[model samples]
Target chain A: AQSVTQPDIHITVSEGASLELRCNYSYGATPYLFWYVQSPGQGLQLLLKYFSGDTLVQGIKGFEAEFKRSQSSFNLRKPSVHWSDAAEYFCAVGGGGFGNEKLTFGTGTRLTIIP
Target chain B: EAGVAQSPRYKIIEKRQSVAFWCNPISGHATLYWYQQILGQGPKLLIQFQNNGVVDDSQLPKDRFSAERLKGVDSTLKIQPAKLEDSAVYLCASSRAGGQADTQYFGPGTRLTVL
Candidate 1:
């Protein structure tokens, strides 16, 4: 079974500061990873996804994540944090088979931007 | 393209009551999914439909939860005799197909509060 782990429950970063959200996954084979953002009272929105391509994948809102096989991590990073970036982020793992495209997500990390 | 759509943005019901959520996927989408997201936790897949057929529903509690996608475009998830623990956000997502690389688009989700 594939599982994702997000260590940080909540994080606060000053506006214009760099931010990184840690994500770890446990999967037997090459896993398809994804980053999703959810605002309060809103559904999730895809940030980016990693299949079998470049290690670094760029997403919307100037977010990027690097897939590190050695560490089994796909951490989300943003150079400059904006007040609008404050939201809950989730890490998910997929790709078990054809009928197993469903994703297993981590608990999520709530980000707060302080001006 | 328009994103997935879910009805009843918020619902409050007493314990043991019945509730249903409706979802309309993006046009031409062949895959639809229902997920349960508890507060402070990641979303968990409850059921998945591939063209009006069940592809995955192992996690759904059949005794209380049931879902169906008719005509392969719209879906509904119903919970009978809901429990207090069942109070969570029910999210509906849709994808182009059942491919591992297909990105899923989510709806605004229906927040369920069982009193």
Candidate 2:
């Protein structure tokens, strides 16, 4: 089965500082990767997705992620984070087959933006 | 466009009680999904439907959980004789189609607390 791993359970970053969240996946084939963010008491919002084409993908809210096939990683990055960026982030992997294309997500990383 | 809609922003129930959640997907979406998110973990898909038909329910706890999308536009998820471990956030999502690359848009989840 395809699985995602996010090593960091919690990450604290100062406002205006750069941010990076690590994500790794285990899949036999080329996997479709996604990053999602969830504020407290809210449902998830897609940050970005990588299916094919360039390894780097830009998403809404000034976020980006790079899919590194050799490392089995799809890490999310932000050049500068704002206080509003504090949220729980999830990494997910998909692309198995037609009916089996549901996503498998990592545990997630809770981001805390310090002033 | 308007995002997915889920009802009963929060629900509290005791063990062995029954509870249900309602979801209305974005207009024109053909795929609906139900996910359960335990505290500190990412959302895990429980069931998926495509145009009023079940596409996947392999991860759903069929013994106690049931879900349906009758008209292919709205969906309902029910838990009978809920257990303590059932305390989690139930999220509903929809996509244009049940394909490998389709992006699923989420709704504000229904938080369930099983006492």
**Model 2: interface root-mean-square deviation in Å:** 1.0
iRMS per model in Å: 0.8, 1.0
Q: After superposition, how far is residue B52 of candidate 1 from its true place, in Å?
A: 0.5
lDDT of 1 by residue, A2-103 (tens): 899999999999999999999999999999999999999888999999998799999999999999999999999999999999999999999769867989
- The window of 10 residues in a row where model 2 chain B has the poorest summed lDDT is B95-104
Candidate 1 lDDT score relative to the true structure: 0.96
Q: In model 2, state the lDDT of residue A20.
A: 97
Clashes (backbone N, CA, C under 3 Å), per candidate, total: 0, 0
Worst 10 residues of 2 chain A by lDDT: A94-103
Tell me the docking grade of candidate 2: high
Q: How do the residues B22-95 of candidate 2 rate in per-residue lDDT, one tens digit apiece? A: 99999999999999999988899999999899988999999999999987889999999899999999999999
**Model 2 TM-score on a 0 to 1 scale:** 0.98
Give per-residue CA lDDT, model 2, range A1-115, as digits (tens): 8999999999999999999999999999999999999998888999999999999999999999999999999999999999999999999999768866789999999999999
Give candidate 2 misplaced runs (Cα > 4 Å): none
